[model samples]
Each structure stands twice: as structure tokens, then as C-alpha cells.
Target: MFANALVSFEQMVSSYPGPLMLVTILCPDPHFKKRHHKRRVVQKPLVDSILKNLHPGGQVFLQSDVLEVALDMRNQFDSHFDVLEHITDIDPSVLCDNEGWLLINPMGVRTEREIHAEFEGAKVYRRMYQRRI
Candidate 1:
């Protein structure tokens, strides 16, 4: 694993030669202090890079145990409503509710932190977005 933001998300994403089909920003850094907010992983540069390099119909999966961070991430990605559709907004199955929050992780696989967080009675906020075709 990379150490201490040794490589930014933008740089890592750019290293790929082709557009990406899926991107997961899971259990991201939660800089709780207001002064440390600048160090947070979910920032504009990363978002721009993802949007530019992601293929049409590509999926972006985001999750965190911190509610504030999760909401911030959701707002950042959902801000680009023209290009990105929140899974709940566009899922054809009509399983998503109008409330905008998801009850569980959509990805079949679960990270250890996610599993443990839930087991400890903490909520894991999850959101999925798709690049519009």
C-alpha cells in the first residue's frame, strides 16, 4: 500500500492509459479538525481527474464510517449532476428511496473496516454514482 499520500489519487488515476470503468474511494482519510480539512482525500482535483478519465457508464463507489465525511463526499460528486447520476437516482430496479441515504453497501465485497465498523454498532455511509452515457 502507498504511504502517507505518497501518490495522490489524481496521479494514480492518471497513470492509467485508458478511461476507467470503476473507481472506489473507500474508508477515506477523515481529517476531523477544521484546520486539517485541506488534507482530506476527497477534494476537487481528484474529482476533476476522475470525471475526466472515467468512461461513460463508469461507476464511482465511496464509503466511510464518518457521517460528515460521507455527506461531504456525496455532495461533491453529486454536485456534478449532469455527468454523474447517484445510483439511487438512476437505478432501474426502483429499490432506492427518495431519502437519498442507502441502508447497505452495494458492492458485494466488504472491507475489514466496514465489517468491523458495522459490527461495533457504527453506521457506514455508502454512496455509488455512475457516469452518464
Candidate 2:
């Protein structure tokens, strides 16, 4: 993934788009263990490049089911950008659809792990945050 990003970065720079809005999502499985957190997608280099590319008011969103990853992301982002909203704090009204409908993603569209967890009746946690404009 990192190699792919490096290649993409090179391509983007060569093409020179108007601006970039990058979102880095990280969710390391439990088996990844403490030392392997470095393997996760969200890291200092990625964040720095993203910030450099993003135009003023451009936002970045990240999500993770792992508590530690979420917390670490929160801390890292807080240092560089103001927190616009946290998923836990979002008002239900803001999450509604264009027709003022509340939407829920059904299990049918879930990832393999999500499907397994649903069958096992396990609870899943999610966090969302956006970078400052």
C-alpha cells in the first residue's frame, strides 16, 4: 500500500491537479499486535504529504474500529488540524439523507469480517473525524 501511495504521489505531482483531498483510513486487526501498528495506513509521512497537498478548506476524513488507532489518529490530527466533528458527537439530524431520511448500511454490503462479526453478534465501534478547513 505504501509503495502504491508513493507511485500515486509521483503521478499526481507530475500531473499537478488543482488540489487534493486525501482521506487516510486505518483499522489494524487485533492480531496485528502493538509493534505492527506501524504497518497501518495512517502515519506521519502520509499525514504530512496529505496536508501539503490539500488546499485551504479541503478536508480529510479517517475512521478506525480499533480504539487505540482511533485515539492515536485523534491525537495526531488534533496537533495539525482542528477537529470539525467526531462521529460520537454528531447530531442525528446532520447524518440524514437528502430526503431527510436516516440511512443504515445493511449487512449485505459489509466486508467479510463485518459479515462474520454480524453472524457472531459482535458489536462494532466506529469513529469519524474531519480535518479543519
Candidate 3:
């Protein structure tokens, strides 16, 4: 698997054999400093690439141990909802709760970071964006 931080996600999306049905970004580095924020993996170019290449009914799954990062990622996708008709349309009963946090891990598996975060009593934030038909 390619490392999200070091890899050009746009190029990865472009070179894939077929439309991506699912894209999962789990616990991306927050890059807390304002100047370093540019290194975030959820930038517009990557978002655009996913939007352009994701097949209809595809989904993007995002989660982070840090609330700020999670919200930032969510907002990035939120801003694109207007143009994509993907974020706003969803089967929420299967995806998330009323407050927009996914109640269950859609992947059905937890990463070591997730388990560690939970064990340490840190809150995890999650959201899903699904393309509309």
C-alpha cells in the first residue's frame, strides 16, 4: 500500500485500473502548525481527484484520533457536497449518527492507532462520504 503522506494521491487515483469504489483515510497526521498544514493529505487536489475518479455509489471513509483533523477533513468534503451531490446524500442509518459521527467503523476493523487511541481514552471522530447515483 502506498503511503498517503508521501504519495501523490491524485496520481494514484489516475493510474488505478478502474473507478475506485472505496477510499479510506485513517488517522492522517494533523500537522498542527499553521505553516505545516499544507502537508495535510486531505487537500483540494486529492479531494478533486477522488471526486473525479470515484464511481457512482462509491464511498470515502475518513477517521482520525484528533478531533481537529477529523473536522477539517469532514469540512473539506462538506464544502464539495454542493458540487458533487455525494456528501449530502447518504443512507445515514447505516453510516452515522444524528450528530454526523459514524456509530460503527464501516471497515469492521480497527487499526493499532485506533485501538491505542481508544484505550488511552481519546475520542475518535469519523465520517463517510458516498457518491450519489
Candidate 4:
């Protein structure tokens, strides 16, 4: 996960050269104020960088509990990309079967932080978009 707010995402475009891949972006913490430039990561330029880096037919997966941040992300991607799926549209029965489905982690394990967040009753909102070919 790239933590730098001014990351040059375009530099990583070649990491995947094929179609139908996944790119996950975890936005900066939502509690940051507008004046805190050091912590904000979801700016317009960064979004553009991400779009440029993504391959055609690739999926960009974004997760955040902050409503405002989510809206901003949706707006930015909507203007230049196509949304392929929303978490709610998935079949409920397939959720439990998703364990170990991801390619990067053979075990497909959830991070300890995620488990703690779930137990803490935090709302986790997930959304996915595709790069327009």
C-alpha cells in the first residue's frame, strides 16, 4: 500500500500488463481536516494518476467508511471511468466462498485491523470501478 499522498501512481502502471486485474486503493483517513494537506490522498491529480495507471478492463477497488470521501471518489471516477459493480449487487451466497479467492495472498486472509474494525462496529463501504477502454 502506498502511503505517500503525492504518489506517482502512473509509474506503477506496468506492474500489470494484462486485462481483468484488480487495483485496490485505500484512501487516507477521513478524520483529516481540509487544511491537512499532508494526510489527504484522494485528490483530483491522484485520481488522474490512478486512472492513467490502470489497464483497460481493469477493476479499481476502493474502500472507505467516510461518506464524503466515498462520494468524492465516485464523482471523480464517474467523470472519467465506468463503474462495473457495487458491493450490494453481488450474490449474498458467494460472500463466504470468497475466502482465499484473491491472487496476491494464497490464503486470502483478512488483516487483523479489518477484523478489529468489524468487531468495533465500524461501517465498511466498498465500491468498484473499471477503466474505460
Task: Please provide TM-scores, in order, for all candidate models, with all chains considered together.
Answer: 0.87, 0.55, 0.86, 0.63
What stretches of model 1 exceed 4 Å from their correct place?
Answer: 1-7, 94-98
Instruction: Report the C-alpha lDDT of model 2 over 89-112, residue by residue, as the tens digit.
Output: 344533534422223321124555
- Estimate every model's Cα lDDT from 0 to 1: 0.83, 0.51, 0.80, 0.54
lDDT of 3 by residue, 1-133 (tens): 5556335677776788987899889999899999999998888878888888888888888999898899899889888775444343455357556667877787899989999999999878888778776
Report each candidate's C-alpha RMSD, comma-separated, in the order given.
2.1, 6.5, 2.3, 6.4
Top candidate on lDDT is 1
Q: If ranked by lDDT, best first, what sequence of candidates would result?
A: 1, 3, 4, 2
Tell me the tens digit of each residue's lDDT in model 4 across 95-115: 312321211222245455445
Winner on lDDT (2 vs 3): 3
lDDT tens digits, residue span 38-117, model 1: 88888887788889889999999999999899988999998998999888778765344445667677888999989889
| 1 versus 2: better lDDT goes to | 1
The candidate 4 region of ten consecutive residues with least summed lDDT is 96-105
lDDT of 1: 0.83
Please count the clashing residue pairs in each candidate, in the order shown.
0, 0, 0, 0
Q: After superposing candidate 3, which stretches have Cα over 4 Å from the reference?
A: 3-7, 83-89, 95-98
Residue pairs that clash (backbone atoms under 3 angstroms), model 2: none
